[model samples]
Target chain A: MVFTTAVNFIRARGPDELWRKRRIFKLAAHFIGRKRNCYSIAVRYVHRALVYATKGRKLKKLDMKDLWETRIIAGVNEHDIDYRTFRESLYRSDILLNRKVLADLAAWEPYTFKALTDVAKRRAIDDGLASINNEHKVDGIITRGALTKS
Target chain B: MSALKRVQQWATFARIWHIYDATWQNPFKSAEVVKKFLMGLYKPIYHPLNDCGDHVIIINSGEIALPGDEWKKRVYFHHTGYPGGASWTLAWELHTKDPTMILKKAIYNSMDGNLQRRHTMQRLHIFPDANVPKSLLDNVSNQIRQLRPVPTRLDRYTAEEVASYPKLIDYPKDYIIR
Candidate 1:
């Protein structure tokens, strides 16, 4: 289409408006009432929903982290170890397992989790971490400090 | 669904019965382990909303060990809801009143206080001794391992076994046998 004059061209809105409205309408299709068919109302709700969707993505990660922490705490507590000390001991021993995988091991593979706790306990003792009880002795673990002591 | 798939589905959702020996085990420590089974935290398909917990039968609760002076130091408080009706009971007193009360309370307190807690506690069956009913005993298909090894007392060793144990040094001939 050709514009007869500069004024006509200036007055003509681009075809992009139709596509934009169509996108918002499609998103509001599941919305109740006139929000699905009416452009003005649909756009408002659609924009709000998109904002919530964006925020929800971030919240999902935080919720999962909290859940994994709870699970790890529960798992380690069963072995008479607190979650902080367990993670610290594991980190010191060069076992860099993240919370997600650790939580999975704690739930799906209990024996493996128990073994991990034992390793963490041994490492804690070797490092003389303050939280650990000195009376609780774990055998068969020879650490760098132990070797150097003799 | 095929017959095999149907059976697999049933197996996946089946509630398993587990038995735990509480002999010589710290009640509080044992409670954490028991709570895992009760809440089905050990299952791969566990969810807070899912009803996937299993049955746990704890035996020999009468022999549970308390660390330090917990028996005398720990106090359980109760109120009758009337004026001056509050009372505190020592852990040993409570134990004497009910051999299973200490362990029962330990497990009950171990879980999060929620609406599901009472329902989950229903799945727990604690026996003061090893005399579980045959009906419940028959359903136990798994055993929850003790958190710590039960040490054998000197009296538990036979006379011959005690005599045969290698000694680093023999007692002086003049030393009186206690």
Candidate 2:
């Protein structure tokens, strides 16, 4: 009897609930599913939603700095130096580069970024912050034999 | 590559665009321009019902510039929606207590006085320092295209011509009046 009642209730309201949830998600999902054509728009709205949620909050300071570090990492990626090593070196060498300017410099000009990265790497090495290799290190995966010679 | 990356890039570009624009115009007005740009007033597709707008990330709000005696004379007011219950904050005090308040006020002024305004205002990102979030950089590119066009300067002759025109009065300066 209970099972029958539950089935009847779901039959009467299940589709409505499902539709409502889908509609709510679709509002900001932008280009997902049938709206794949509007992917860029959807993506932008989602990004804005995240940014908005953190605004005016007292904890926003902690939140935004993380955002800066992430941008720095992405910018540093172009220079073949991961964010961790570069930042560690900066910290060790007492070199000061705020994340805001670093992110801007990285995005606006990648060539200058490469030069900066080279300088950072040199500084890191001088400060004895570079990682040292152990004999047990894994062998290189890409051998010369796999190369296609011209 | 990621949506987060794109938004951060857009925010950074928006900041640079605003700074350069301010330098060309008056640096004192940069805060006002930043507020307007974030409000979607300059977009071609702006519509009353739609909340289509760009996200604005404001960094170092503490370091923004103001013109003249604005820091002393400007007042921010808030009321409890009651008779004779208004509270006021002087600009200089607001700056020292919380510099971010100025940008927030500018943003609020730019928003429409409607229910949707609050929702749209959420897209403003104001950070007083370099501490932006880490999760926001998934797809940021090192390649930023600073494609903003320089605004045209007003012709000096146009203003001069307007001033040079004879001051036409209903009566001559020397005319006798009762």
Candidate 3:
């Protein structure tokens, strides 16, 4: 029975061969159209699917970054600093805070975010960013950074 | 207000503007401002994907003044998608046909060519004069500054100022002979 040892089973590696190429067919069972039914078609689709899955890993990072910036911008409007002004102020003051952390603070810890906004407002005012909406006569709640500057 | 109404109001931060076009500005440049306003870029809440922009009520479009010879030079072209269906029209002619067309076209062209542009255009309400619907006028939250100061009109001159205007030369009684 063991005349050829493990080499005897090597010749039986076709579609019906258990725990071998058929395993790939099992994984590709849910694929669309001929990709699921035909063994030859399934091989090509499975390769293509894996390629797409790898590429999506990089794309997801950029998409999340854009989303975080948008959320941060939505928060900035409430505290009287527009997105451009807030970003500029952070750059000028060397805050080095990323948009993800900033968005978290804005949504969860609003007071902390407002404090940061006030800091940006003061720096932007000092830099004379023309569109910073410097006429804060109405809001009454002055940003803390501007208060510290005075 | 009902809960639904309250939710509706909270969803949109709609601010109405009263923009003026006294001196005719280059539509190419000024239309960008209109597009920005419609897209809510003036607000911190503005996101390219979101419909967070405000309504714009442009007034005094009838008095829009043109600079240089653009009135004669600028032309708008169109095609009917058939043989020999191409046509061209000057800016002034379009403006005459519909007082709002010039500003509307300017705003339309300045916006990005996409589906969202149509929604933004919907928020822009242009009028030939200061007349606006009562509902819209009542909702106006703020007034944006006019584009530029129009030159003082001759009719606005006082009698005394007109009579005292400096003269280069005083013509004699018989000065008409020349």
TM-score of candidate 1 chain B vs. the reference:
0.92
Candidate 1: where is the Cα deviation over 4 Å? Answer: A1-60, A68-150, B1-10
lDDT of 1 by residue, A14-90 (tens): 76788978888989999999989999999999999999999999999998888788788878877888889999999
The alpha-carbon lDDT assigned to residue B153 of candidate 3 equals 82
The alpha-carbon lDDT assigned to residue B83 of candidate 1 equals 100
Task: Give the per-residue lDDT of model 3 (tens digit) for A1-150.
Answer: 333667777864455445555776887888889888777788888888889889999988988787678678767867767788888888888999998898777656655677788778777776778876556422333556556655
Best by lDDT: 1
Please list the C-alpha lDDT of all candidates, in the order they appear: 0.87, 0.55, 0.73
lDDT of 1 by residue, B1-178 (tens): 5555432433547899999999999999999899988998765556788898999999999999999999999999999999999999999999999999999899999998999999999999999999999999999999999989999998999999999999998999999998
Q: List DockQ for all candidates.
A: 0.08, 0.02, 0.15
Docking class of 2: incorrect
TM-score of chain B of 2: 0.55
**Tens digit per residue, CA lDDT, model 3, B16-102:** 554545345555566766676677765434467767778888876765666677779889898999999999998788788887888
User: In CAPRI terms, where does candidate 3 land?
Assistant: incorrect
Candidate 3: residue B159 lDDT (0-100): 92
User: Among these predicted structures, which one has the highest TM-score?
Assistant: 3
Q: For candidate 3, give the lDDT of residue A23.
A: 73
